[model samples]
Target: MGRQRPPRLPPRKMTGSLPTVILAGCGYGAIDALRALKGQARVIAINPYPYIVNSGMSTRLLSGRFSLDLVRIPLLEHIHTNGAEYVQGRVTQIQPEVQTLTVQTELGRRRLAYDYLLVNVGRELRTIAGIHHAFTIRPAEQLLAAQTWIRDCWRRAAQGDPTPGLLTFVVAGGGCTGTELMGELYDLCQEMSATTGIPLTQARWVLINRNRYLATGIAVEKEGQNNRFSRCIETGIRRLGVEIWAECQVKAFGPEQVWLEDGRELLAQTRLWAGGLQVPQWLSECGLPVGPEGSLIVDECLRVKGSERILAMGDCADFAWGSQTRRLPKIGVYAVRQGPIAAQNLLRLIRGQPLIPYRPQATAFVCVTVGNRIAVAKKGWFIWRGYWATVLKNLFDWLYMRNLKPVRWREFFY
Candidate 1:
């Protein structure tokens, strides 16, 4: 993909000036919106973190293949270069009726008023009892912590005291996160075994899924197409000596074992969760039109159903589209695409022009890396796996970051 500058956005030239367009969340979607409407509107971005973690490359972070500083870029620099203000605060409450936001900052709580609002705060992890006992990849910090723990485990195994479960790395979830995690773990363990002389048998890699196969609910077609993709991933993982436990539900977590719903216990100390994502609890409490997952309900134009001035995007939004009003999936790919669309629609409304409806592509592309320079990608009926797939994944990751990089960073790279 070639580098193309975003359309320059100068403030709308109307009879009177408008209030600032406040975008909450500094994820891919929010940043894209900020890029499009940077100079066009008085834009302010509110996010708890100071950096935007490139989750596309986060899987490599697990295996110590990539560093955090490389994947996570400072949002302040990006916002400043794009001619926008970055608010280092978390939005505690949103009052759409008064168009005021209660933000929690270092100087205590402050109320911010905005003419238009964009909610892309995204989802929170669906936690369970003893979830703290497991490692998660949502926050970039968690990945750093996991890296330390994994290295320590490898060292311990080298000393002949490969603690139970510590060597048996278990990833719970069959989705993209789980699949990528398994691949990275496979390579990590294999490299550690070869370097430290730890037997591969001593180090266990397991993937537990409630469903019978992996990538269960993606754009996979029926008539065993899902199984075909599942088999492809299964082959890739198993070839790397990974164990797959299907149709099994994790009941609870323990320090040294994972209890199963079927009265079975898996001996493993390390558990990585990549399943069950839910929107923030505050979204539903704020009296907005939220869906079952606590995501704000948005119309085809990506506008919040009840309030025209307020819009929602990314994983934080439950969008209804087309005649059937089908709900879209919560994927980073969609979030990146929706950013400019939402920005355009907002600009159209500001200019008194008709808002265009967002129509998602019928087939969503998805890929999972399978250790040792291999990956599996699915686009409609076509499925590719091997070295070429891995090359595609790397190119895609570079393009994703390249498109979202700040002006200064883009200058340094390009």
Candidate 2:
């Protein structure tokens, strides 16, 4: 058998006839660009996840309201619609001079050559020691994991196994995500304990953040000072029987407790970290100009600094306007708006036309939900809270998903 070994097969090679445009990541920005580039060239979309999860609806996933399928859009469906190739892999390296990308696939490593590249790998959650003790409301997997954990804890509670901290849920970070998570979780616990003999009142929910004031809520930061909006959010959280610990830093997460910097310990059966988001390390380590947060530094025109063939948008991009000291907020709207501009600029580049600069909208609106049918909207100094705010938030989310999942399946065989 050893002497009768067969000949090895040769590596497959790509024909050099088509110009390739590689869109890395299936985030809001990347998807938009992929749609725009349809029929223009041979597009290759690469993403590690098989589905594109809508972050806006992630909170609802924790509750029993939305199923995983409701929030996930298949990446392959989009690729098929645009007549593009979809590679389920992560980008390992980007060689600018050679215009090639090193991708790590399930089978093995593969090389992709591209005439243009759009990097929108997005950001990852910040973490601390014993982070495994906590759940993060990030991509679909994290949200699903947290959902499972919550259900398991509730089941344990129903079985009279409510150990110390087993019924207590602690949410670290007072940012928009953290605040909303605590609110949504409060509702979930209430629902789970409604008829299970485990009264919701027995369940404890806590929020800890180092920031004296939350960035977005009923209150807006005025001139770097905490104002009434902060109090409003605190009042809402308190009304839900949730405790708030401002200016408190999380030192370490124990198996069943959270240790604070001030030597205080909290019993948390389930801990959720909505602390903050940081750009992926690969962005900075790949020899590109990156900000302190590891996000790619992009110019006004949404082009990556020091390169015209490369561009970055969304949470992965650090873009500033007139004020170089402050960067644009990493929100969905900014990325949505940047998509068209990036597509236009890219098309212009291909046509040897001048690129258009992007001007960020000054006053961005942010809506943070506290509970079902209750939310807060902040726009500059204007702050509003009511059912209408929640409705508006849902509307925005719906509009975004509607634009993303387009049905354009005009196939053309190569």
Candidate 3:
């Protein structure tokens, strides 16, 4: 025998021969990986939930048609809350050699040991020059709160004393999140007027896209992209009464407003910064090797460099797919995919077998809800436009959530 390989370790409980597995982050990445682990190892999770709002969907949630809760997967509903141990804390530091993490929780500072460690902690973004800030929705409750504000704004506009900025809801990114958000709110504006009796003129869903054209990535056909951009215009970007500004970068921020690259300035009391996302600072702080974008550079096995005991996935990880270099686009699909891989690799480690590498998909699709019961579906060489696309998109969102971490755990067990 090759020096007698160690036996596959069993999952450690409070007291056991197996070591603990400390998984940070409760996002789709963290929670997904943990759920796939089954009984391979002990697990612990940390996240500041019932807090943070991404605001991408905030405006839509605020409008009261959909609840913010629709966006988040509660950790307790999936993780440690059932039987595993969970610390309502954030991991401030990770030491690989000793395999321990330093965390600050409601109780206080504590160091916990682990046999295997995972860093799924998602990234953070700042708005309004990093002062007086709001966050993306971390829990479902945040959506309900957003609903209240939308109602209040409706009240002001309905009373004929509409605040100058009350009519404006500026979303600043062009990513799928921002794209869907702006488009959703635009639809809500139409619904609010028709249903709540509030005039469509009272609510504005302004999308500030830095790209010269919206859907920059999905615009596969150079002419088709231009045609789609034209369609957005003809599709009532202006006729729907929502303001659309492209290639407008933020020059400066003010307490109550944002100055744009264009000479013409926009002043809105409600400023939402959806201007894309930078990777988290903590990955660098934890002393792991990071790529240019602040994401962790992982080997083919999804293992962080210079450490065999640690792994990364989702938004924080950069893996080589096939081409020059790529991270898995930091989407729900990739995170969900990484979950099973991470779990399998953990088992391989426990069994002293070859670790399996994660493979990327051949293509992906984006389903965006456009106003008037219409949606736009963009995939490689394919575009499904109209109400049917919106219906498909809504159905997809429902089914995806339903199967992955569905409302009922019994389904998973069975």
Candidate 4:
């Protein structure tokens, strides 16, 4: 089947005298841009509270490590550390014709203009209705709701309740977040069992993906990485004794059960959509040049088409992926790398200098954690595993966050 391209967008004017850079979406990508432009422009960063409902960090949070609040990657705090403005609200509209943005905050409807704009609104999983029991957190409020439900589950488990209830979890995507959630949940159940004595096997752990083989088309040496992830799910379920139904497509949901297309109906408590993210509807509604994924079409220098004054970085921008491909993943790494390049380009454009073409790197820094214990590294032909890989993964996660927004090095040692 041919790929369904994004609708064509009408062009806008290229003139503006605004003294602001409206950086939207405070996820990993947006934060990078915010950090880079700390004192250059009056930046306004927007985002929901560090996200909790995406099910990306379910295991770490559900393990009772101070709940989901502690797990959130706060957008405001990260930016404030580098001296920037933050608006905690939803961006309801963007009007590029006048180079203005409308936001709905607690204070009420507010408007702002931009000299340069970088949209980094991360992505949201596709959530279905009538699946309230399996609530997924995308926004800040949803994470609070999910956390409340978890507390209730813990209460019931502690009471030795054996009733089949609607507190089960089924992750419906097997990408990085899905795999990590499944493995982490397995560990959570084990840890919870020791605390509540409810038998870890009582909780169900399901990876409901459409893919036949896990991580298909993954590199050969990285087979160990893929297998380690698959085995983490398999051995995790075996040792913890949980249930998993792979290659199942969810058709609909009942009050206490979820229906699969293969004539299987499983009693489920919650159905997490780890499947994928779509572009924000508002962007398309703006009639700008957006790619199929709702990513703004930009040149090598990350300038939005038709408007040399406008630029987008991170998830919202559709820049080339690597040295070969013309599309990139919506990963934090891309945003982090692009932040410096985008800033350099924007600065050059501001100073009336030659714009540098963004050269996407050939190799990516990948550290896929199968579960909490193990992770595998892959870059070009390099693939290695075991405790060393996990160590490297931790170091990478730490250094990635630190290097992007450098913190006091003494803190790490102290």
- Which prediction has the highest lDDT against the true structure? 1
The residue-level lDDT of candidate 3 at 22 comes to 76
- Backbone clash count, each prediction separately: 5, 2, 9, 7
Flag clash pairs in model 4.
53-137, 54-137, 134-270, 134-271, 166-269, 168-269, 321-327
Error of 2 at 60 (Å): 1.4
On a 0 to 100 scale, what is the lDDT of residue 163 in model 3? 59
Backbone steric clashes in candidate 2, count: 2
Q: Runs in model 4 with CA error above 4 Å? A: 1-18, 29-32, 35-39, 50-59, 65-83, 140-160, 165-168, 198-203, 215-244, 321-326, 403-414
Q: The CA-based lDDT of model 4 is what?
A: 0.60
Clashing pairs in 3: 53-135, 53-136, 53-137, 54-135, 54-136, 54-137, 62-146, 68-143, 69-140
For residue 85, model 2's alpha carbon misses the true position, in angstroms, by 1.1
lDDT of 2 by residue, 1-414 (tens): 012212222322346554578887778766666677787768899999777877767777776556677667777787888788999998878888788888899999999998778887777778788888888777667867887788788888899894887888998999878888887888788778875768877788889988887644322135532355665666677788888888999998988899999999988789998888887777777787988777888887777888867888889998876633457778777787888888776665554566778777766777777875588776777778887887777776666666656422221000
**Cα lDDT of model 4 by residue, 151-259, tens digit:** 5675686886665753476766666666655655555555556766676545666677666544333332345555664554444333434455557677767766777
| Alpha carbon RMSD to native, model 3 | 5.8
User: Which should have the higher TM-score, number 2 or number 3?
Assistant: 2
Tell me the spans in candidate 1 whose CA falls farther than 4 Å from its real position.
Answer: 1-17, 220-224, 406-414
Q: Which number leads on TM-score?
A: 1
